[model samples]
Target chain A: MRKLREMLDKADINQFRFWTQIFFFALFIYGGWWALNWSERLPVFACAFVQDRCGSCYLLGLQHQMTAPVSRMFSLAGLGILTGFLTFLIWFVLLNKAWCGYACPLGTLQDWITKIRSGIGVRRSQYSETGFKRLKRIKYALLILLILIPLAIGNTIFGSGLSHEFEIPFCMICPGRTVLPIFNADFSQLMIDFSTSTKMILTALGMAVTGGFFVGAFVKKRFFCLFCPMSALQYLLSRLSVLRLVKDGGKCTRCNNCVQVCDVGIRQIAENMEKGDILQDDCMLCLKCVAACPENDCLQLKFLNIPVFRSTDTGFFCRMEKKERGI
Target chain B: MASEEQSRMAQSIRMHLAMETEDVLGRISMDEAPQAMGYFYRKLRQFFQQPEGLGHFDKPGIGTFCAQVPLELIEAAGARPVRLCMAAGIWDQAGGELLPAKSCSVVKAMAGMAASQLFFSGVCAVVAPTTCDGKKKCADLIETMGIAVHRLEMPPSKLSRAARNYWRESVETFMAQLQGWTKQKITRKSLHTAIHRRLMATEQFRRLCRLQTKGVLRAVDYFLVTQTGFFDDVEAWTLALSDLCAELEARVAEGRGIEKQNRPRMLLTGSPVLFPNIKVPLWIEQAGGPIVTDELCSATDMFHDAPAYDETCLHDMVSALCDRYLSPCVCACLSPNPDRIRKMISLCRQARVDGVVYQTFSGCLSYAMERNAVAKALADEKLPLLYIETDAGFEDQGQLSTRIDAFIESVQAKRRNF
Candidate 1:
């Protein structure tokens, strides 16, 4: 068992992450052909827009459930929302933010775009510290709008009610709805809806976001993840999750190696010395920090507080040596 | 290549260095000392007595004055890195003639060596990190002696984002300069291999440190083992350290380690204590206080941290190297550096140290200014600290020894009362 753990700790994490991402991407994008269904409350971005998707993202179901009349929001109708959330939490706690790192189809697509950018010798862009701080708040703001906009559609707010087109306000602008279905030869969502000005504006906004997603992801890694409301919601309950990223402050040298390689550019993982649980709001639990840390046991990927993959000098050197040998 | 006058001066300095080296070696050689220690002793003797035989002469040597200059880049550029910080009083006097009366002894010695044409004999260029005022001036002094000097500007504070970016750019610029000098592009494969080589040495160094903390290795022996890396080949030094660690492990298993159980264990910090000038450490050991660990750049801090790049790409690797060299450095030269106190407290706890012996040279303004802050922090942790201010000369040896002995006595008495 110890030997197995040593092997895992020194394993090629990039290769492991790549294969795991491919498996989940295939399962979510084409699993319906095999009659596989993992419930509509799945935590990751297995888009509902994909006609043959095995599971749908929880955000869509959440917006729909929250659209019930405000008068019956706390009644028996509300119990359905409660049950859906409970199921979503159960699935979320199993892997935590790894849903974004390894399972999310949208995230996988961004990673592929980034790979292409690097393959062509184009330099990737990164946010400055001030820019990162300011942009990180967008996700929380979107989370608020996603929740309140749906509720406002069901009830009066400021002496007015929103149209049904704004019922799933976030999903209306989310690039996933416009991009994911293309894998299934479904590009009908690409056109603007002219039934009403509200529908036309929302659908046009979605198309523009899809175009931005391609160009943005090509230049920056995990661009859409910066404003992902689902990530904000997961962070609110991140403490209840079983998987964690832990840091031993005394062992950390604040080398910023983790910061340089982070997909979401979470600087707290390297700079925060007072915090042991280093899972920041933007952390995708990608375990790249754990692999980059040179100090022994400085950063760890823990399942229920038991280290599954730890950073060690031997492990760090072995990985680099393998890279040098092109193995 | 040496003139008659320069050769005579080199002969005189070599004689004094050899005597000082033999004196320390004689004191460190004990029956309980590990057989692997002989390798380090021979390496040190060669460094002082036979400078030309230190090897690596096939490649152009790059002289570095501080640890901030990444050695991996130098090696990757197909050049050898020779750390030029000296602690001998002979070189200090020789260099004192050119500098002010109250200059840092380490830099003075380096300038003296450069003046004599003894140290920078075959070095093609020098990479000098402006860590302190003394080093910056020393770079200028070395440049005047006709050796090319590449000055690496260090940021005053590493806490700000601007500083971090500036440091990254500075390191990248230094990489370009080195490549230009060596006429060899630092390819990703070469840099990766260089980083791996250093990591291998770091593994062995950490093992040696663990043994030192366990009281299996003497303080002087540990210092010698690390100081040898300044002139020795990285691979050779790592192999010798590994052999020493294996022997120390066996001795620990046999319960044949240093028997200083009753003495107070000490953690040495502050300015670096190099070879032939390790008076404070020698005094601490002779006074029955064993130095379990140290936080000196000349020793533990030199190889303690290794770069950990997440990707194999050149850009990420260079950025990682910059972070590794800058962020973790607890040198007093960097301002608002609370990391030094935290590191000291942590090292104290890990080594089970009863007191800290902070040594700063008389002219080392940076370290001397940090003495009060370090003292207050250690006192808050209820750990006794003894701060010593002296130069490279032996005029104050008796006074320094008395103070070390008294501090150890007080620590032992405190333990007894508890």
Candidate 2:
């Protein structure tokens, strides 16, 4: 049975994995949308849902920036937390962020935007292609924070005072509040609970992020990653993940071919240290490097040091390795 | 039809008279036009009159390579590298200062540096690769003896093996002379160490890249790290970098890499930016995006170092360095077949840049040619782009400011859907 499973996996590998990842992710999203009860739909506007909103509100409160509306929102945030926790539990245990690979709504949204953006002006290999594939970790970190911070806050027993609620950590700049269409509604309705002082604080945080992003135009690449606490949080979580792209040192040429394509910022050394594996914490794992890699086996994500896919789904990607051995 | 014809004829006559006036203008002032080389000739004459003045030219440095490498040879032969960059910085220095607005800023700042005594103190030899007229004119201002001047005669074409060989020989001979003059032994170990140091430093550069992985890196930071190649002493840089690497690695290991997440995600593009305009790069990072990969003079994806295969069988690393065909300063610019834009496009595409800000320097005819080529190339790739021309100065804020704003807008627009 094991041999049969391995053999079935062996044929047209990358294509199969790529397709399977897409199929699974699509199914996951379709299922989520189907499950989102009707009354909950538009209420999620300007926010991810009650679960995410409640989490952010409390996190804001912990930061001493929360308003009554924001505080009240947290009373209902159990939903985002529950869904997020359940999804994460499945992701960490069953597939190691296969949620990112096959199911994340935010990740899916980013993919659509990326496609449109690339179609308009971005391309796979038009110019300055370094670290192109690595750009995904920006969101991955955000996702991790969306889960961990709220849980950490909910469990804290620091009693009563405003300082006690400081346990909610992701409040001020949580991207989930800003990125989802649900949040767009929340922002539009000004549903935020606030006194003038608290409102000012929320406004300051909001303006700082919005204004900063606009200014970051000529300023830098992935500027949000610089300040994204979620990115910070995920950077910790990804290290222990099961799946990763690994480099077989013997098959490597140190040509920087992989660095040429990583966008998420995986340093060539970090990738190389992992033996050129792309655990790709910084990466969305969109699989761009797996395509751009010139030498076969020079790049691949592994689970406990085993090749999962090598460029193009052909069962025979070890061509570079074979060629090197001919001598 | 007849009236239009007359009008055209009249316009031609006015143009002819204007030409005469320009000729008379040459006769009138010191910064006049030369009749033969036309305006360039007059600028040349005036430029030479104030040879060591600001904006005149850059002089020789401690070392030499290729055609420019000869100045070092001449200096090492006991003639001081009393090239323009030297005297221009003296208290008495005053190469006819070029206008601030019209000139290239790189040309201006470098000239300004030389004129300020910050550049050419105690330098005694000079070599120059006559790759550009700006450099040639800069050399013309120096009051150095012809014997002291060493001009590297790089075959304008880069591909021919003979030209490469000529460059190699010129460098070797210049190096030998430099050794003779400096009285410092040119040991193989030092050169090897330099190469190895650079290799290691280049490897350590992985930190800036890694930091950006999770979000701590901004686009501006990307630009700074990518261009670390232009700094002095690769060995010292590597040593210093070790500290930075450890700090950043610890952060990443602890999963505390990026400080925040509100910054923009951007792709770096443009012509090979020469120097860190300091403010521009820092501002870019401050403004919220940092650089990632670039197609600058030093940050070539072709960046690599192959160890001498037969280590036991001693090898001359300097010879190896020469063979890189394009060293930091001498590459595409000095090549008989200079095709920097082609290489630039290839690199940008490989890097998956979201946009390109092509900075064209004033008076770089070669770059002018590249402008259209790169635009067309990017257009085909469907990559959004912005082009800015700077004379390499902080003073030209009007043009730079406008271009920068527009560039930021374009990037923001792309980011809006986010």
Candidate 3:
């Protein structure tokens, strides 16, 4: 450990290094994206016989299973299920937001491009914490609605309840695939083949979802965070995340120094405070606060007691270091 | 017999004028120059002899400031601070004199004084914040002729840290500019002394506000307290204050303080309520209501209740003053934060008000902006809220009557619940 510390004493990591790590993380993400690409990727539980699709499979990137490209290569349906659960565990436990932070192909590409094309001044919506936070819940709610009540009109005289089927929402909505198509696959045919009823549903869903994103991006940049219920899901489960933002408030000067580097605009510590070396929601657990913190060793990315990153979380490491010494 | 009658009337007039002149002379400090003294004497004589209704100070929404401005701040600044109050005995004289019956009675009374040329013109300046949409416009209308109407933009933000900074800055700006305008380096010693001296005026004002002895404040005597508008002498406005306070104190001591009327306690807000307005007060009284005090910024008696601090303590003084009578709800142009509404309603509760009549104006940004929060607050309190929308000139009373009747009924129902 001493040797590791001595080795990196002179190192000054910069944005380029962070960008380099993001590139590797994307390749790593391909492992899970590959599994969902398979056809006959039958869900394991009673859900398969009872319902056609599962939320986890949709999460695993199973847009369509029958014509899935990876299915032609791999025969076993269980392998796809196995691969997805493994990926969820890896991402959920080890690097909760690693997919969003470093590995998400779309996110990485966006970051790289954004770095190069930097003239887009922050939109007014990004600055209004109260306004933007209030609006972000709509997206996560849509995700839950899209998955949980898929194709079901809730119980009534004309009852059509939640459909347990793959939502055509992604095909109808995600412009990201067009910009950077995954697997070099064309989704246009899949989009056109959906029945008229499905098309209307898709179109309505598309208008709501797209309008929300565009409006969020333009009006209050990242308005999605305020209403996106999935972020809340991620936030609730973020306690299990290895990477977390830790604040050494004793060292904090109340100068509001770390707020600018944060993509999400949480100004005060209480609103932005997290337990470990990485922030919870809106953090992407990217160690932005660590980099932005002016106070020495005020923020850190720690693995157990080890300082994986030279962050503000290190003082607590040293404090623990002293307690162990006392023992 | 005609000669005898004329002679007797002349004697009575002479005696009244003499008593009024003595009252004025006694109140003036010896430090005042002969001209200022003479001005005081003339003002007293004219007011007593003619007693033209002091309606300018009695405008709708004006009662809020009239109740707050410490008479000492006015007098020491060499200004006469009036109560701008109403529901006094002079309503018959001042009411409907200039303002139409449909107009806000408080506004009508003020218009009466303006039409009668009683008070608003003979003043150095008027001081109050933009307490409400109606009052702000009225004060602006009265701001010409170097009248220097100072409108403090009372803080409108939440009561958090960010809001506090904004309010402090506003307070600094208002007090500093006012210091420059008043031509008196209003020091801590001066302001503090003025606050201490204002205990006398407060005591006096409390006397008239008492529901005893005179049944209610005679509109004529209410006119005197509201004359904090006429001059800028903090120390000298106590002549009438002394007389009124003495009479009320004596009455109270003699067990004369009894409930002559069982009018409902109402929190009058929105317009600059002037005294002697027959419409608003009369309507309130008809509806079994009597306005105790109100939440107005200009010409409401809030200034008197404010505690004076050391002048140098800018932020502390501002925080105190900002919270004194001007809460975030005062600046209804901004969304009245839930906390602001909660605070204002709590104040209503403290004042033991049975109902709130928030006078909103069409196209006025402040009241309209705060309308939702104020509504939500009233809903929370379960208090009946009457939102009266009026024009800048309180010109439409027929439009307000049915709504008023309904609101009064709602309050009566709530009282029954209690």
Candidate 4:
């Protein structure tokens, strides 16, 4: 038991996160085309939950297929689609936005871009408090727009005889539709869909969004994660998550280490005084703050009241020494 | 031989201090004067002497600064643990090559000692704790100079579960390193024995502190007793202190203290005051106010809290070590260092201290930055705290004397009216 405890202490949590990201990134990007025989119609958000080109697009398509035209009520097939959504929610609750931290292929891609940027000695951009707050609202707005546009299209609330191009409204301009296929050695989404003026405009928007995500992620840590519609949805439902981040505020010395190491730059983890559960909206449940906190039991990662990992002074020092040496 | 050197230094300092004492107490050695302070004074002087050559030891000598490093671990590894703390008094030219003028005085003195390899040559390894940026960078510099330097990272937050775990791991790592250096296995038994010895030593030291608080023990005697632990082996030092405590308790029972009655009582707080660097405490006593207690790392701070070790398991012992070290530490490196201020306020109430003499050496930013916060906290309780910023220089003696004298006089006057 002592030997096991020693091994656990020596284990590097960030190393575990790194390999987990790599495993999930490969699975999501290559799984469908390779072995599982999963189709594009398989209503799962794990594939890539990006706005405009995400699993929500497939969900909306399934809703249109199952429900009677102009009727908002769910058919038997629509309940199947709802079950898919429930499955996604269950998975989300299990990890609780750790998908953003450990499984998001796009987030992992952005991290790779950040590493390249750092390798070239390009400093990452930091957002001021007000700037970060203002920009933080974009993801929620995007989520709202994603759900509303698809709902209107499915119900034919707009003019009748609309083109099939309007079927998945968010998917029409999602950057992932153009970008994520590159990982599978597919480049067909790179072509401009000049079939209609609307298709051409959507393709152009996709290209632009892809370019923006690339550059922004290069200059900022997890840049696209800041406005990820999927992240916003996960955060909204995270209250029911069994996975939790706990802070012993009395033990915390307000050292600002949690803030410093936080990829999202959330200060409340350290500054919180009226504390019970301290998961911020921007928190990815990355547990970087847990790894970085020098105080004993100041920050804890709990899975249904069982401690998985905790911040420790020795671990903090070891990580910091590595950071100082630029390891 | 070390004792002889120490007595010589002690004699010189007493003679120098006697020049000032004449104006206050009228021609008497500190021994004959009050509480038999001269004996403890001699002990402190001897401890600081650091013999002509580093004393012969069967095992490696592990040198460290700051109160964070646990000496018992070194002892358990069969290595001699030596405290390398010093003032600018003995710093040689070697220190100037590596450090800028703005560097902390303690680091400069340490660098000088390390570079000369004259006094600190016996140290086979240096266990440097990253308490402040000065010490952290100094450790790096020293490591590059080919000394086997182990950097101990103390988590800035004291009260956290993470900090405690990390400290225990750090102690374990250091223990392993010490065993490797000394080529001896540090058995669980030896580690527990070392911890038990420390607990015993600290208990005796606490007794002296309580006696000092009650005015039966002089400030100088307390300083002497505490600083001796830095040099002497725990067993001998504890026995000596145990004997001293018994003698002091007897005096207390007999209703005998220093000749001067109702003198102003002040609590000393700040940087570690070493031997030969006893000018600050001397001035405080000479000003007609005995320092009833101190919160400095080198003095009462080291003894006030004993590590409550569980003898059952080694891990529990290590946990106790972390808690005890991290808990009492009021070092400026920690954010929201309310414990130091809180301890001071509580000590003031218990010791019936009239004022506080807060000292900070120049360039010791940790204590300097904390001085205002401590003063403000004391102010809220309507306690008078005097901030004295100086170095190991004797040039500031007159200035220190005037401020302390006025502060003591004010306390006395206030008491007379109250």
What TM-score fits each model? 0.93, 0.42, 0.37, 0.53
Q: TM-score for chain A of every candidate model?
A: 0.97, 0.54, 0.63, 0.87
**Ten residues in sequence with the least summed lDDT for candidate 2 chain A:** A37-46
Q: Report the Cα lDDT for candidate 1.
A: 0.85
Q: Model 2: number of clashes?
A: 107
Per-residue lDDT of B245 in model 1? 95
Scored by lDDT, the top model is 1
Question: How high is the lDDT of residue B124 in model 3?
Answer: 41
Superposition error at A231 for model 4 (Å): 39
Chain B TM-score, all predictions listed: 0.96, 0.65, 0.55, 0.87
Residue-by-residue lDDT tens digits, candidate 3, B1-418: 9767745644554454345445433433443122222433455455544443334323111122333232333433433454443322232124354334554434444433333333443444566555444445545544542345666565444445466456556656656655565566655445445544554444444444443223344322333344443332434555655555565556556655336334456776654443222245435544555565555533233422323221123222333344443332333444433433544564565556778887753444555567676778777877677787653222465666667767777777777677
* lDDT string, candidate 2, A1-327, tens digits: 666544533443334435665554344323344453222211011133333222112123222212123344467764554454444333444344344434344344444444444345433222122344444445555545544444444343235233323233344454434444343334542234364565556545655665564344223333444444433433456666676656654444333334433434344522253345445444545454554454445566566656565542222223222222332
lDDT against the true structure, per candidate, is 0.85, 0.42, 0.45, 0.68
- In candidate 4, which residue pairs get closer than 3 Å at backbone N, Cα or C atoms, i.e. clash? A52-A170, A52-A171, A295-B163, A296-B160, A296-B161, A296-B162, A296-B163, A297-B161, A297-B162, A314-B166
lDDT of 2 by residue, B1-418 (tens): 9767745644443343334324423333333111221322333233323323322224233422122332212322333333232111111112226423344444443444333333243344445656565555544443232223445555565544465567677667656666765676545444444444444554556544445444544443343333333322344445545555565566667766355443443444333443334334444444455444555443443233222211111122344344343222323355433244444444454444556666566555555556676678778977676666554334676656656666766676777765
Interface quality of candidate 1 as DockQ? 0.57
Q: What would the per-residue lDDT of candidate 4 be over residues A1-327, giving only the tens digit for each residue?
A: 767655554456677888998887667766654554333442223434322222332334443443334354454556756666676667667878787788777778877887687667565666776789899999898777776655565566577544556556555565666677776667778777898997888788878888888889887788888877777777788888888888876555444556655777785775575447898778877787787565556687888987677776555545544433432
lDDT of 4 by residue, B1-418 (tens): 9767745644554344334323322222356334444455455444344332454645567888788888878888888787777663545234656798777667776776666554455778899887988888888888887898987778887766567567768877877788789898876577767766776676667767777776766565566566667766778777777777787788777778755558888888988786446678878887888888888888866665544321124554565566566655778788757777766776786677888999887778989999888888888878898988876646788888899899999989998988
